[model samples]
Target: MKSVAHVYPWDIIGDPGAVQRILDLGVDAVALAASYHTVRAATPLHPEHRLVDARHAALYVPVREQAWGGRRLTPAEPSWVDGPDSYGQARDALKAAGLPVYAWTVLTHSSRLGDLAPEVVVRNAFGDRYPYALCTAQPEVVEYALTLVREIVEQGQPDGVVLEACGPLGFFHGGHHEKTEGGDWGKVRQALLSICFCTACAARCTEAGIEVDTLRAQVRNAVDAGEPDSVESALGAELASALAAVRTSVVAQLRALLVGEVRELAPQARVIVHASADPWATGPFATAAPELGVEVDAVVAMCWPGPEASIPGIEALRKLAPGTRIAGYVLALPPKPIEAAAMRAELAALAAAGVQEFHLYHAGLASGARLAVVREALDSLGQRP
Candidate 1:
């Protein structure tokens, strides 16, 4: 089994000991953020500064005018981190230390871009715009995602690429100080609310033989009634299935375009996606429906929900893409105790459930103690690659 640790450019840029600390973790590679959304990250072990407030979504690489010329949805350069090419600088240092690097590219999750172009963002069933989610149903958003990937592969020259939010984002916006929990919405209601009714999406659904207004009304009525336990129940079987087909189709098209771009740019680079087997899933881990035939080197399932939730997801993904490796996106941060035994058990459980890779989350933000626990857990699992 292989192990890859997630990190940021700021984690490596000014910290002399960053490379050595990462090496000590026994990871085979590092998934460094190439393009990322807003975050006030904590550099627990950096020598220069402790906190980095990335005020907006920005590309870590230098934003070339030629690459983004005439494009309205171009990526912004990071002002929080010093230097024009933080990704390049960090990539060079990690490569020098003999650690393979994967460009962790985030797509369709930029609030800054969405705010600038409201029409391109996701509009819910009630026509409420999610300013944080760039609706992939829009042609401009698709073009932006492709351009971003092209830049990362052509410039960053990574050994691999890990794609996040490769499809349309829905109601979830983590960093926006969300206040929706007050409504007491269940998982079913949340999924319903996630249904996009934007111009492009509605058109797509209509083309797929769905009544746009009727479906929207049904969605609203479902929310009001608050009776249905699942999306299928709320929208009725036929409508629900049709809606899923449309959603999955959108995700499938975007994934293919991005993956094709990556393959064309660098055939040797491994392609990994943060994904879910569930057809209705959205957000960072987009749906990797088996029927669509996910074409990637690996599928990384979010394992922060623990073994019970994560194991089944991994199993489902394994069945979906049997040829591709399954990676557990394991979390070692807060809410998860900094203990080797506990962490090792989770890793072991995932491995047993057919997870061929372990993708450790946030090596940059983790404290020395937390990192130590990660190292110990990997050591225990014999996962040092």
Candidate 2:
């Protein structure tokens, strides 16, 4: 189906006018980033506006701590988000939307720097705090990460689930190992890595006779101290494989745990991966993803570099998961606001890509006039009958 996936704008989520507001535009499915619970979370631009109390069909959830927060999402505390009641409301709202709400969780990213819960923190070579990626290698972490997903499935039984990353959600490979998919040290030093130097991970590696410490040191020296060849000849394949294994297993467990639950509840549920779609994308992820609930339906990749980026991205998606739906997560669409000439150009390029669904990244920062512009954009996208 030809639909526009607009990012749930902050305006819509936080306002009473949200429902009909986007309807005024013509877009159907919205990714609605942020705004996971009973209300919408405030953004820097609109601080006073607490999350609006609304009924939505599709909702996005954040399960980690980056700019979003600094803790694991749970039925209590920071993770509870508005309250566990919010989870139920979230699902109900999505049902109202006649859409499914997927928990866009980041499994590996843990925010606490040091001495955090063993199940949550990712370690470094120096035994420092690279507390980002949860050591999926550990059974505890696998069980822990699925806490919210299980809740969502059992309690909310929403529609489907999407992913932010196989690991964390920030500049993914932005700075440390930005171009390259990250190694143990790169991950650990970024203070956001998901390696587990804990006895558990080492033990597993040792059983395989893999010198966990030596490999860890190689990664650590390269990442922590900026050692050259830190990445070069640094056994990226092995490290990547290990990390991927951790992530894969974590997802696999999640699938093992949730798949049945989902099928029992919403038999036709879809599992989408929210990850980057790149060509030179290095690291163990490509090989490792299938380990997680392997039956992923689609991936949501954004259009930051514009339409040209979409071309390669779509190509990458085809390679990664053929027949998997590609939700082109675009930003800055007009009508509901967030528009620009650059966006227009990028959109033109995306139209050229083999995109089936155009998922606008969000719905926010809009006025009636802007929403009007969004309507125009949609009509332009698919000659609205």
Best by TM-score: 1
For residues 197-219, write the lDDT of model 1, one tens digit per residue: 88999999999999999999999
- lDDT per residue (tens digit) for residues 175-257 in model 2: 22245444443433443233446666677677665777677766655564553342324446666556445534434454455
The candidate that wins on lDDT is 1
- Please state the error at residue 145 of candidate 1 in Å: 0.5
Candidate 1 achieves a global lDDT of: 0.90
Question: CA RMSD for every model?
Answer: 1.0, 7.4
Residue 382, model 2: lDDT of 60
Off by over 4 Å in 2: 1-14, 32-74, 77-84, 87-119, 166-196, 224-232, 236-261, 276-293, 333-341, 365-374, 383-385
